[model samples]
Target: MRVTQMLIPTLREVPAEADTISHQLLLRSGMVRKVAAGIYTLLPLGNRVVKKIENIVREEMDRAGGVELQLPIVQPAELWRQSGRWDVYGPEMYRLQDRHGRDFCLGPTHEEIITSLFSQEVNSYRQLPLLLYQIHNKYRDERRPRFGLLRGREFIMKDLYSFDKDEESLEISYRKMYDAYNRIFSRCSLDFRAVEADSGAIGGDVSHEFMVIADTGEDAINFCSECDYAANMEKTPCHIHEKELVEEEGPLELVATPEARTVQDVASDLQVNTEQVLKSLFYNVDGKLVVVLVRGDRLVNETKVINYLGANRLDTADSEEMLNNFGIPMGFAGPVGLREKTAVTILGDLEVKCLFNAVAGANKTGYHYINVNPQRDYQVDHYGDFRVAEEGDPCPCCGAPLQVQRGIEVGHIFKLGTKYSEAMGATILDEHGKEIPVIMGCYGIGVTRTMAAAVEQSNDENGIIWPAAISPFDVLIMAVNQRDELQAEFALNLYQKLKRAGIDVLYDDRQERPGVKFKDADLIGYPVRIVIGKKAISEGLVELKWRATGELIFKEKDKIIAYLQENLTAMKSSKR
Candidate 1:
């Protein structure tokens, strides 16, 4: 690719709206352009990088015996309805009506469509195990799309589904997909980990998300550094504390906590640790107000609460709703002589249930109850660990200390079981000719997200240091002064040689200043750069620089190709 003929619109200044380093460099390098809030158009350079990532994914998927197929982007709403996801998916799904008034949707995912497809043709156990995949566009109505491609309303994705006859076969397929995902991310030069994750709306029994460590990620991962235990914050278990309960001699007493409302305020005024105080939060669970109690020091895991309540949806109660439902104010509401007449279900944490003399709300302004204990002071219906695991917490698996890290989710494989197939009526006949629901496993990779993540994990201050496996161009041939006929001729000659050697080359033949060209070269982050300058031309040599290490070496013109060949081979070998 020649810079003179290509639209390499390198910018001298970063865009004001660009937040992350990847977004800034991507915009400055002319690789992508933002069209709307989160939508972007990948230019030639960006497209090449994305294609390279996709090719890696495709090869790994193929190696894992995955048969690729293109599923429809716009699927009929009936498929979603059949799978019981039409109402469950909620606002994230982009729904629409055709001219004839038939309901349809731009698929946020394709579990229903794929299950429906398999149900029609795969009727026998003979075709028991099938792994089908597709690389296509996906749409989601993101309420607030930000951070460029990191979180987008529309993006490209590679979604694969596996169908099996039973649980054993499904596990086999799931393992294969999991290994393939590891290879895919490994090939892309991503530092990632497979952590346990909640299935979310994509109903499944077990799931694992491959996350790339990045500071800009939105998801928080709680991982045990000493043991192999990691989980998404939503599903992370709060480790049980072994604190001995202190038995109180007196009964529950209502005290004037005057002007103390928040847990911190009440705890501080009472001269107690946050853990000594009980925090009560109100949430709308299945159209009814529910008061949840937990240790003040712990944060609520809403996902766990929703799963525990067997509710399809849950959200925190707003102040107005809280005022309307509970007569007490927001921060002062707690379980203490509260009317059991209201259909409000009370839920407490394991620690709260074991408390002997815990403080709680008096349900009146500027007042609270002291020396209150559960089972004696108030009755609670349910108790569980509805709090998110925090740092220094013990691991549920092996009792190791837990650590927290932010990671970008690149891929996920889920043992969906009969969640979709059963709902969609995708069944196959067994050996006995009895019909059984097809077990399913879902595998997915964010094609564009992987590209951005590569940039996120690999880049320095200069720009994106793309891994050689997915670089837009393997070698960048930069002519310091294109107007100099000799430099231009030397650059063109070397470019052809590299191309003939089956190497990808991007020839910078533009009449730009050396400084501008150098900045752009680094910003684009090609693995290797060969500079044809005055000194190099005069000395019958070319300056070779490694983008990753910023190491520079002088090579004879005749040896340029050999050096690059050897360096590329070493880089490729290192990746393997």
Candidate 2:
């Protein structure tokens, strides 16, 4: 492709609206442009990169026994209602009404539609073990879309749904997808980890997210220092290590703690460690108020709380809400008289029970109770692991201290069991002739998000260092001086040769300054660059530069093509 013929609107100044590095570089590189708040239009270069990534995902899915098919983007409300997710998705789903007043929605996911299709088309177990997949657009009306492609409302995705007759068969399909996802990300040259994750509205008991490690990532992941155990922060289990209380319990006494509202403030006023202070937090769990107690140093893992209570929604109760509704003090709330005061269920962390004569709020402003023991002064309706996993926390698998890192979620695989199949009545007959809901598994790769994540994981100030396998063009052929007949002739000839040799090469034949071309080339981030400068004209050598390593070498003109052919091939096939 020739640069003069292409719409490569490389920008010198960063756009003001671009927040993330990927978003800024994408706009400046002329790869994509914002069409709306959460929508974008992919230019030629961006489209090429997306297509290449899709090809890699498609190949992997096919190798895993997936059959490619397209499902309707506009899904009927009845399908979602049958699966009991019509209101569950709520405002996130893009809903509309047709001329006939029939309700429809742009699908944020295809579980309901695919399961419904299976129920009507396949009945016998012979048709089981089906893996249907498609690379298509998904729609979600994000309440606050930011971070460019990372959290876009409209984006491309490759989702594969597996159907099997039994749990054993489902395991096979799940393993296939798991292995395939590993290869796909590896091929894309992503520095990622497959961590245990919550399925959320997807409705699965077991799931794993392929996260690309980046400093700007929104998700925190905890990985064991001594083992392979890694999980999303929300999913990492906090194992209870009960410590026997050594101090004897004493009578609880209320004392003046004026102006000490926060945990740190209370600990400072009492001249004790934060761990000696009990932290009481109120939450509205499915319309009921509940008090959760943890050590002052620990934070509430709301995901764990939601899973434990089997609640649809969980939100923190502020001081005003507690005061107005339950007649409880917000900043000075405690479990000692919480049950008697409001009769709200107290969900206590196991670590809290280990404290002896702990200091706690008196549920009254400007007052605290010292020598507050768990069973002696207060009662816990339930004791469980309710704290967030942090650095140095013991790993559930190996007891090693955990390490924390930030990562962007690019892909997720779920062992859906029979959630969708049962809800939609998608059943299959077993060899024993008994009708049973089909076991399911779902795998998805965020096509656009993965492209953006690649930039997030691997980039420098120069521009985006795209993986060789997914770069828009494998090599860039440009002349330092178009007016120089020797350089132009050589660059044009080399471009033709590279094209003939089956290399995706871009030729900068425009009448532009060498500096501008160089900056644009680096910004666009072609993996390999070939410069036809004085060296090519005088010494029969070309200047070769690698975008990733910034390595520049003088190569003989005759051997340049051969070197690139072998080098590019290896770069694309290299595993992570």
Candidate 3:
């Protein structure tokens, strides 16, 4: 492709709305443009990158026994209702009504549609272990979409669903997809980890998220320092670490705290370590008021709480709600008299059980209880792991200190069991002629988000450093002076030769300065750059530079093609 004839609208200045590095570079490089707040128009270059990623995913999926089939982008609301998720899917679903007043929605996922289809089509165990997949657009009305394609309201995705006869078959299918995801991301040159993750609304007991390692990522992952254990912070298990109670079990006594409200404030006023205080937090879980207790130094992992309670929604109880509904002061709420004030359920973190002679709220303003003991001053309905896992926390697998890092989730695979099949009645008759629900697995890769994550993980200050396998073009040939006949002729000839050699090459033949072309070359970030300049005419050599390593070399024009063929293949084979 010739730059002068192509629609490459490179921008010099970064846009105001582009906050993340990937978002800024994508917009500035003219690969994508904003269509709306969380929607974008993929320009020619951007589309090429997305298509290349899709091809990789498609090839891997096919190799894993997946059959490609397109499902409807718009689905009937009745399908979701049949799966009992119509209302449970919440506001993220793009719900709409037809002119005839029937409900429908743009699909955020196709689990309901696919399971329903399977129920109608397949009838026997012989047809089990089926894997169907598609690469298409998905819509979700994100409440606060940001980070460009990473959290877009509308984006491209490749989703594959597996239907199997039993849990064993489902396990095999799940492992196949898990291995395929690893190959797909590695082919894209992503530095990623398959961390154990919470399934969330996907309704699965086992799941793993392929996270691209990046400092600007939204999710925090805790990985074991001694072993292979790694998980999303929300899913990382906190093991019980028993601590000896230094103080004897003293009689509980009320102490005047004055205006201390926060845990830190209470600890400071009382002259005790934050760990010596019991932090009481009230949450409105599925409309039922619940109080959770943890060590003051620990933070509540809301995901754990939600999963434990099997609640659809959870939010922190506001001050007004605490005072008006529960008759408890916001900052002075405690478990000592919480049941008397309101018959709310109380949950305590496992670590809270080890605390003896701890300080706690007095259930009255400007007062706190000293030498408070669990099961003595109050009772807990349940005790579990409710605190967030921290960096130095012991690993659940090896007991080594955990290390924390940020990462962007690019793919996810789930062993869905019979969650959807049973709900939708997707069953097959066994050898005994008895019908049973099919086991299922779900796998997904965000095509467009993968492109953005590549930029996020691989870019430098100049612009995006796309992985070689998915770069818009493999090589860029630029003439230092297009007006100079020697430079222009050599550049064009080399471009043609590379193209004929089956190399994706972009030729810059525009009437632009060397500096402008060089800047654009770096910004667009082609894997290999070949420059025809005075060296081409004087020494019969062309200037070659690698975008990734910035290695410069002078090669004879005759040998450039063979060198690129060998090196690009090696580049594609190796992960970044």
User: TM-scores of all models?
Assistant: 0.97, 0.98, 0.98
- Worst lDDT run of 10 residues, candidate 1, spans 241-250
Weakest lDDT window of 10 consecutive positions for candidate 3: 325-334
Model 2 steric clash pairs: none
Q: What is the C-alpha lDDT of each candidate?
A: 0.86, 0.92, 0.93
Q: Which is better, 1 or 2, measured by TM-score?
A: 2
Q: Specify the highest-lDDT model's number.
A: 3
Candidate 2 wrongly placed segments (more than 4 Å): none
Tens-place lDDT per residue, model 2, 1-576, is 998899988999999999899999999999999999989999999999999999999999989899999999999999999999998887999999999999999999999989999999999999878999999999999999999999999999999999998788988998999899999999999999999999886787889999999989999999999999999999998887688878677878999999999999999999999999999989888888888899999999998888889888888987787888667887788987787777687898889989888899998889999999988788888999899999999999999899999999999999998888899999989899999999999999999999999988778888989899999999999999999998899999999998998989999999999999999989989999999988788889889999999999999878887899899889999975
Each prediction's RMSD to truth: 1.6, 1.3, 1.2
Clash number for every model? 0, 0, 0
Candidate 3 — which residues are off by over 4 angstroms?
A: 243-246
